[model samples]
Target chain A: MDKIEEKELWPEEKSLMKAEISRRKFITSATLAALGLAMTPYATLAAAPSNKPVNFASFVEINTTINGQNMKMKLDPRTSLLDLLREQLGLTGSKKGCNQGACGACTVHMGKDRINSCLTLAAQIDGKEVTTIEGIGSETEFHPIQVAFMEHDGYQCGYCTPGQIMSAIKVLEEDHAGSDAEIREWMSGNICRCGAYKGIVEAVKSVRDETYDKKLIKRTQQKVS
Target chain B: MNPFQYSKAKSADAAINGYMEHDNTAYLAGGTNLVDRIRRDVTHPDYLIDVSELPFSKIEKIEGGLRLGAMASNSDTADDENVKNDYPIVSEAILLGATDQLRNKATNGGNLMQRTRCSYYMSPHFACNKREPGSGCDAIDGHNRILSVLGTSEKCIASYPSDMCTALAALDAVVQIQTPNGGKRSLPLVDFRRLPGDSPEIDTNLKEGELITSIDLPESSKAFAKASHYLKVRDRHSYAFALVSVAAALVMENNMIKDARMALGSVAAKPWRDQEAEAMFIGKKPSRELFEKIAEKTMEGAKGYGENDFKIELGKRAIVKAFMKVAGLS
Candidate 1:
């Protein structure tokens, strides 16, 4: 429906295709009309494909806030937001055990909503607000959840501590996860391979029961709403 | 894994043309499934066409049901207001798939295209015909406890891993594709993923130049809104893939079945939507025997070898459990 699809192709008869033109050259990629990548050949293996312009996932500039910190970065579309923060932005607090969404090791808050940073692409983070483990509070002023995790001994090997913290923050955002069993069910995604689950549960319960503040609730409510 | 070229497609034709130009061009959206695989060397696309910027990111109520852009992330779709009220089954299925973080980044199209997580498939060193055709299928003779007994062959035994897809298939979605002719086509959700026939390499019937643009779904059913749920059983709690899963929607008129739809995942070559099983419940009441019979009908063609024989029973149990919930007996 755009200018590209609307463009009329100058006639190139399909009948003119030479039968003996080697199977390697006959892959006949669908890029007969593209403008980004096929224009030039890639390495030797795919050299037989058409000369139409092809494109790969490109780098883009994203201006966003992470953990109340506003920052800008030029990131490859393929670079997950979790990697961008943990690897590129010097935010080493986030962990990465199961990168494919299974283990919730790389959890972060985005626009007040907690999300698994590992599955999120940096480009998708543009114009949104993100909060990493480093963003929660300064050493002089620890976030209540952070203090609770520390006090509750909410970690053993500590690989999943950051993600556990993020999940606990988002637990209040969800309306369904209630009761100790529900909390356990909701927090189940953030696995502690070290079997530090009891500590993680205690850390979450401590925040929910005693230290949950109106200010934190307000921000989370605004996000959930 | 390798340093590949990247491009953000402005049009569907541009994406298709990009694919035509390179033998290894793959459309990158969400990258939840593809990126991890690439890191493990499961997929080796030399050129990645960025389609996230294309119009395929929108999730709106298009026809009677919702029209989800191919790039519409699972978290967004699960969180959409219309989806919550109208297509709750879709939302529920997505929610049951992964955690909030993963759902936020997984696209509907990419979710369906996710490769099976058969241990053999992920271990690139193992023999997996799905990863490398004719490499020799190790799962057939190996530990394939969670594999597809339905629509499976000796060539492959991996079960589809996306929990969201199980519900989408039950809802009768349509996948929109723009082909090389600049003409658009749609494949039914049930027929999108090719069965593990002789060639496990071909996952979908998609032609060489086709790019999935969106998924057009049918009208949201009242049954789905009133009584629908997805149940998955796995070794670990939240983060692991399903060992046996069920996506079911049922409506009852005075305790008699008025309508039913059921799909199974994590124990099939694809998300298995069986109308035959649904037929057993069309006019029947939910009873233990009736539920067992319905489950049996679903596995009418199940054929398993090696470690997956137990899945047949697990698959039946999972669907029965869903019926119990639908019947409000639980």
Candidate 2:
């Protein structure tokens, strides 16, 4: 606990995260107190501990910026970037589908490249910038890809949408979205069990060609204004 | 997932020292395969040394050909202008194997060092001699549609799953290694990976604590720079391992084959190269009959298990088709 407290937050995101962390801590403590349960070291609100006590001695410290918020954390070496985002930082936008590299539901941008967060350890992300689904445009200001997805009805269950969007963004930036077949090949890593590939390809193509409904984007921009 | 200690090495010597000092230490480069295996409980290490930031990530023009850094990511290596122009087979093989995201994270050295995708070797419930040395073999009698047919021993038959190495084998690339004593040595890429003859546990000829620094493509390989193709046959069109892949390059002069290079992937414990079979192509005119005969000769002595018996035929067809494309016969 002392080790986690010693970690510092970058000034811009400090107050927001501090308040969020305090509320979560309070809720955890109250729940444990109501149950009259002993505080398991692994379940404390400060940070998620490793399952084995042997790992506590080797908690690796990392300085990273996630979703544009600079954070310094001492993480269990076993904690993947996905776990660090969802478990410790309350950023659940990055879903954990397979918790393996086969499924790209945990895709996120690490230094301009879309990578499998589940396969990447938190210890490896030191001095790197990570961007998750939550870091993109807000509700009022939807990113072009988000608007395109909506316009094309790109998702059925929507579980794989975040990962699809993240990969699609790179597909455009890398100039791989020039054709539907190219988009499909580039986006093959992220699987949509609902078989929504046609819509996903259309959405990515629309975004690349700037062909998404301009009226919808105008409404979003108006809301932002 | 197992908990381990992680440290970053600032230099090659420091990385070697870290490996020498620690027991059961793995050099983490890209961590695409190592981390996945750790999560699967296939292999466990007490410490992980970060070697991804090493200075060996540059692709430079050397005396003969190109020197590709071991730590360079597969995407960067494939997209490199020199590799694309001089070694198109390497780019095609690398790009066709994995998805875009994986290509961005997987390094060339790590791709060569990756383990097989055999089902028995992957799951703990099944008996696998490669994962555990005296455990017994399950893939021998089990479903092995994706296993090897060319290089099967009584001990193990796990196919080496790498596309880049197949092209490297065809090109006769050499691996540069830095020993623990700061001495350097180079080995032909064909001899780097070993067959699973008596020992399936050891995959490569690399000794303990030795680090791969780069791979050199000899200038002599430019002979086949114009006509080369990598044909991979998989269950899916993308994002899957190859069942049988053929890498072929041919040099033609006046309608006669001047020089030829060929290698097979996902059909053996290592990249399958048959110089004797390739030699037959020299001075021969391009023909379907000649290609068929050479393909047969290349696949000689190949024995497949029940499910993978089709690979022998598939391998022959892929070889023929690859040669046809390379020679512009079809």
Candidate topping DockQ = 2
DockQ, Cα level, model 2: 0.21
Q: How close is candidate 1 to the true structure, as a TM-score?
A: 0.80
Q: Give the alpha-carbon lDDT of every model.
A: 0.74, 0.85
Please, what are the lDDT tens digits per residue for candidate 2 over residues A145-165? 988998888999999999999
**Number of the top-ranking candidate, with TM-score as the measure:** 2
- Please give, for residues B58-111, the per-residue lDDT of candidate 1 as tens digits: 888775677888888887888888778877878877876676666766688788
Score every model by TM-score: 0.80, 0.89
Interface RMSD of the predictions, in order shown? 13.6, 15.3
| Residue-level lDDT for B162 in candidate 1 | 80
